[model samples]
Target: MRLSELSVGDHGVISDITGLPPEQRKRLVALGLLPNTPVQLIRRAPLGDPIQIRLRGGDLAIQKRIANCVEVCLK
Candidate 1:
């Protein structure tokens, strides 16, 4: 499944980030969202364009477009 498809409060592990642009992929990796790393969907904006995720001890607000680029597996 894609990260954007995960429900709020759900946990999932990153399976692939290669689907994203090189710069975006690098940015996410630096944010600790690497393959095999677990992440939780914390919340989403009212319109849902941006979603909050928890991973590696930090929370990041990622755009839905970017979120969709992240492949994930449910934990």
Candidate 2:
């Protein structure tokens, strides 16, 4: 499933990242979002645009559009 489709409190491992602009993909990878990494959905904005997630012991808020490019396997 796509990371953007994960509900709050869901946990998963990243499987792939596709369709992102090179810069954004690189930034995410640098932030520990690489494939095989564990991830959890922490929260979402009131309007559900930017979603908060935890990975590699850190928290990050990412846009849903960017999240769509992230494929994950439920954990």
Candidate 3:
């Protein structure tokens, strides 16, 4: 499933990131959104455009479009 589809409090390991521009992909990786990393959906904006997530000991808010490119395997 895509990260964007995860429900709040869901936990998963990142499987892949695809369908994104190279720069965006690298930025996400730099922010610790890498394959095999554990992540949880923390919350979402009122309109759901930006979603908050917990990963690598920190929380990040990313656009739904970017989250849609991130694949995850639920734990």
RMSD of each: 0.9, 0.6, 0.4
Local lDDT at 35 for model 2 = 97
What is the TM-score ranking, best to worst?
3, 2, 1
> Backbone clash tally for model 3?
0
lDDT of each: 0.91, 0.96, 0.97
The residue-by-residue lDDT of candidate 1 on 1-75, one tens digit each, is: 999999999999999975677887888888888999999999999999899999988899999999988999999
Evaluated against the true structure, the overall lDDT of model 1 is 0.91
Q: Clashes in model 1: which pairs?
A: none
| Greater-TM-score candidate between 1 and 3 | 3
Worst 10 residues of 1 by lDDT: 17-26
User: What's the C-alpha lDDT at position 30 in model 1?
Assistant: 85
List where candidate 2 sits over 4 angstroms from the true fold.
none
In what order do the candidates fall by lDDT, top score first? Answer: 3, 2, 1
User: Where does the lowest 10-residue lDDT sum fall in candidate 3?
Assistant: 25-34
lDDT, candidate 2, 1-75, per-residue tens = 999999999999999999988999999999899999999999999999999999989899999999999999999
